[model samples]
Target chain A: MAQDSAEAANQRRTTARRELIETQIHEHAARLFAQRGFAGTSLGDIAESVGITRQALYYYVKSKDEILAKLVADLTSSVVTRTREIRADTTLGHAERLRRIAYLTVMDRARDRTRFQLLDRSASALPPELADAFLEGRRLALAELRGVIEDGITAGEFRPLDARVGALSVLGMCNWVAWWYEPGPDHPAEPIAEQMSDCAVAMLRSEPTGTDPLAALATARASLDQLERQLRIDNRRG
Target chain B: MAQDSAEAANQRRTTARRELIETQIHEHAARLFAQRGFAGTSLGDIAESVGITRQALYYYVKSKDEILAKLVADLTSSVVTRTREIRADTTLGHAERLRRIAYLTVMDRARDRTRFQLLDRSASALPPELADAFLEGRRLALAELRGVIEDGITAGEFRPLDARVGALSVLGMCNWVAWWYEPGPDHPAEPIAEQMSDCAVAMLRSEPTGTDPLAALATARASLDQLERQLRIDNRRG
Candidate 1:
């Protein structure tokens, strides 16, 4: 029994060390990939940056290919997993669930900005099968969001619009967080996430009856005309 | 007078030929940059792809640096210029102007997907000053969009929300077209732009005075509860 416990403890240490090494490699590689284009960055560069020998680096990752693939796979699976968790919560309403999903996507992308940027810009560098999987993963995420929008429409919680278009718009809005978000002492991720959630929900909500956009424009135009006329009259009086 | 006319005609021909060559070089270079990345692609590769000697290529463009700069500058100027035009039109209401700006952004991005992709992915490759300029141009464009949103709110044409957030959300929704849009015989830029414009407008329109998002959710919950109660009563009766 003591021998078995010792073996289990050894296994745990190995796993923990593996995790630490993988993370260090990824962070270093991502910085290199960002500074130099992915094509310009090499495994040797990553190893040198990580302060490890190439052979030691090989123990953590077989190639630069594996690191990117792992990064993209983790990004995809985490999105899928988190989205499912939000979906499985029966207590939340459809709109609230959507808000959470939108917020989560923006937050996740913001927190892992470098990883997502690599995923976006360097996706072409991935191997053929890996590229295909990455695309499929994105397609699945978009489809999931579309399904939620459709459900909300059916539930009378959302306006009836093209679900595909809505999903794309929402995803685009959230995905852009990776491009411009920066963490600062004064600015926190929570507020940005909440703001995005509100905007997304605003986009999907059903239009109130009797509020035609064109009609609203017409009203605004008429009001502008009246204001202009009144200003002309005042100018004449002066 | 005859000599001057001849000189003018010769200048026109030279300009036209230069334009043609520049277009060819840009198209080929953009493809290489997209496929192999900016750092991976070299000027010699571009010249070979363009079927021109490297020296001849220099006559059209000083370097690849100039090509990318021209592309980014053109993109920024076009967006800034177009947004200004939309803003200048007094006949169109605020929402209509906003819609056109949104539509134009998406359409422009969709039509020039390759150039836009290069601009986005190769941004880091630009000289530091160039990168700063590029970011500033983007900031100006977003601020212009935000100004329009603020005008709409002041005019009482849109619901009051954080204009900065609204602008970012709209721009994000439109910028994403570069990532996924593919032009085809059946899929035109117009419809996609229109759909996105509609979505953006939908996101900004004033909610009906009587409708509250949270209140709506509460009502939905109550209705669900009533349905469950009715089902229970029917089951007991049976």
Candidate 2:
């Protein structure tokens, strides 16, 4: 039993080491790809940047295309996973869920801004299968966002609007952060994410007058009651 | 006099024809670049696609880079022009101006979706001067957008928020149409533009409760007046 356990622990260490190296390779590759066009970048350039031999780089990735595919897959899968989690959370209101999803997306894009920028510049050049996978992932996330918006509208948490457009607008607002957001003291990711998420929720919020007729009436009644009390005090003074 | 007039009219016709052919070249080059990418495309390929000889293509554009530079210039200049006009229009309220600007941006992006997609994929590869010009134009438009949002907040038409973030969110919402919008009967540009513009306005609109304290107070006063009248009537009946 001791021998078997030792072997398993050794295998786990090896696997972790491999993953760490692969991640380093991906990071170096993405930075190089962002600075130099993917076509202009080569496996040797990435390997050199990662301080590995060209042959050693082959142990982690097959080709430059594989690195790009992996980057895109990582981005898309994370989006899908995060959005799916938000979509399935029953404890949160639709508006709150949407806000959380937008916040997470903006944060993710900001964190991986370089990779996102590389993808933006090279997505069209991706091979058919890779491109399809990336696009499918995006479509899944978009659908999940739209579903939340639809639920919000039905539950009267959001204004009645085309859910698809609303989802796209929110997605666009968050995704565009990849293009423009610079992580600096002046523009931290947290506050920018918060602002973007708030804007997304604001886009779908129902107006106060139309959100709930009963609520509006009650508010008016309460205001009138207070005003009447003040008027009586003024009458006594007169 | 007759000969001079004929020469002037002939010069006008030549200029018009040259302009028409140049537009065609740009359209074909943009489509090819979008499909094959900037690096994959060649001047010969663009010329052949435009049904012109390489030499003739040179007459229309000095090089492929020139064509790309013109495309970027056209897009950026149009954005700067339209937003600047909207910024200066004193007749429209800030919200209306913002809506109009968003609407026009969406419409413009939809119209040039192909070129915009090409630019998105290849902008990083642009030579420094061209890229600088494009970025400067974008910055100008963004500043105009931010200015409008600032004015709206000052005027109490919009919520007090980071105008820069608000402007970027709106800009992103509209620019994203270039990536996803398809011209079809089901998704006409006009309606989509309207939806996007309305969303932009919604993002910045002040809540009714806070938009105008005086207006809220007036509403309360009107409700109190109605309630007092009803009470008097009930007292008379008793």
Candidate 3:
């Protein structure tokens, strides 16, 4: 009976340890994929990253394709869900909504650049069906963003523009944060997000209905000056 | 004496053929690097693409690093030279210069994506000294671009803004063309360059001064409409 009890406890411990190791595998895979790219990274590389044998990795993941599919799918769904939540928040004005979306996109990228890198740089590694699904999710998010821009134009809150090109340009700017941003305590996501949000606003800024053009340019210039000052302060604090 | 003359002619022919093969090797290597990434591609892969043995490839390129370095350096010099030429053109105004620079950057990328891909995406794979040189070239190009923006603001052609951010953003937009653009005769670089230049203007547009803000927005809107129409026409022609 004592032997039986010990066996049960041992089995439970093994399962828990397996779960922990799998999580580590996922994280290490993400980091490697982000740095080296998906195609360049091998299961051997991932196994070495986790200090495990290839056989052990196989117990958790059948192939790199499986891991990539899961990572990309999860990222797609989360971005879509968060974007929907932002869209549902009707209390915000059109420009504010666009601002928040831009801020949140940058914040998400800064928080987990690995996921963004995988989705942006390695989604092509996924199997066709999985890639299609992930792309659909991304397409939906883009449509939502384009919808907001269209609404803004209708309300004369934004200058006239091609919604598709504008949406893509916004995403391009935000996605690049994943490529360059390195988070620090002093240089937190809030300030970067704020600056990016302002950039989005300026990017979509309409011609002034009543305000002077020079004055409008001056406002943009002042915001840029403020942003640079904030960046300096953050750098000093760091 | 007759035998010696024939030998010399044969030697000249061999040298010419060697140069041609080396150029082919470089082109094939670049295509592979752009498609499969620098790390994922091997000398064997490039050799196969060029229909040669790996041993033959080594006759032209010592390693993949050497090939990438050459491609990147050549591309960097070309871009820097072109940008300087555009800047020195005194006949054009500030906004026109910015527009031409934007168009030329995109046109250059579209003309030979392989070079841009090597410089932008695979410069990390270059040896340290080569990588530093390429980066310095990029820095000079960006500084020239920023200088133009500063001049524009000073001349009151462009609205006041952070020249650094504006320059980076412009580059980001132009660089992305390398990733997505598929070159064709019908969809030439000229129209795309025009649209992108207009987009750059719209992005930096200041508030209305003496001109009606609504009219400015209307003009921006008209340009976008024109761009879309041109795209459709291109698609039909293609």
**The 10-residue segment with the lowest total lDDT in model 1 chain A:** A222-231
Tens digit per residue, CA lDDT, model 2, B1-238: 9999999999999999999999899999999988887778999999899899999888878888889889999988878888888888999999999999999989988998898877765665677788788888889989989999999989989865778888999988999989888888787888788888998998888655534455566556777687789679657967
Predicted complexes: DockQ each: 0.19, 0.21, 0.11
Q: For candidate 3, what is the TM-score?
A: 0.67
Q: Whose TM-score is higher: candidate 1's or candidate 3's?
A: 1
Arranged by lDDT with the best first, the candidates are: 2, 1, 3
Report i-RMS for every model.
12.1, 8.4, 9.8
The DockQ-based order of candidates, best leading, equals 2, 1, 3
Root mean square deviation (Cα) for candidate 2: 10.8
> In candidate 2 chain B, what residue range of length 10 has the lowest lDDT sum?
B207-216
lDDT of each: 0.79, 0.83, 0.75
Say which candidate scores most in DockQ: 2
Q: Best TM-score goes to which candidate?
A: 2
Candidate 1 lDDT over A1-238, as tens digits, reads 9999999999999999989988889988887887776778999999999999999998888877788778778788667777777767879988899999998998888788887887777667677877787887888888788888898999887887878878888999999988888877655666667667867887787654434554344334433433343333333334
Docking class of 3: incorrect
Model 3 ranges off by over 4 Å: A1-27, A36-70, A85-94, A127-130, A153-161, A185-192, A204-206, A209-238, B1-26, B36-67, B88-91, B153-161, B185-189, B210-238
Better by DockQ, candidate 3 or 1: 1
| Tens digit per residue, CA lDDT, model 2, A133-186 | 888888998999999999999999899888998899998899898988888755
Q: What does the lDDT come to for candidate 2?
A: 0.83
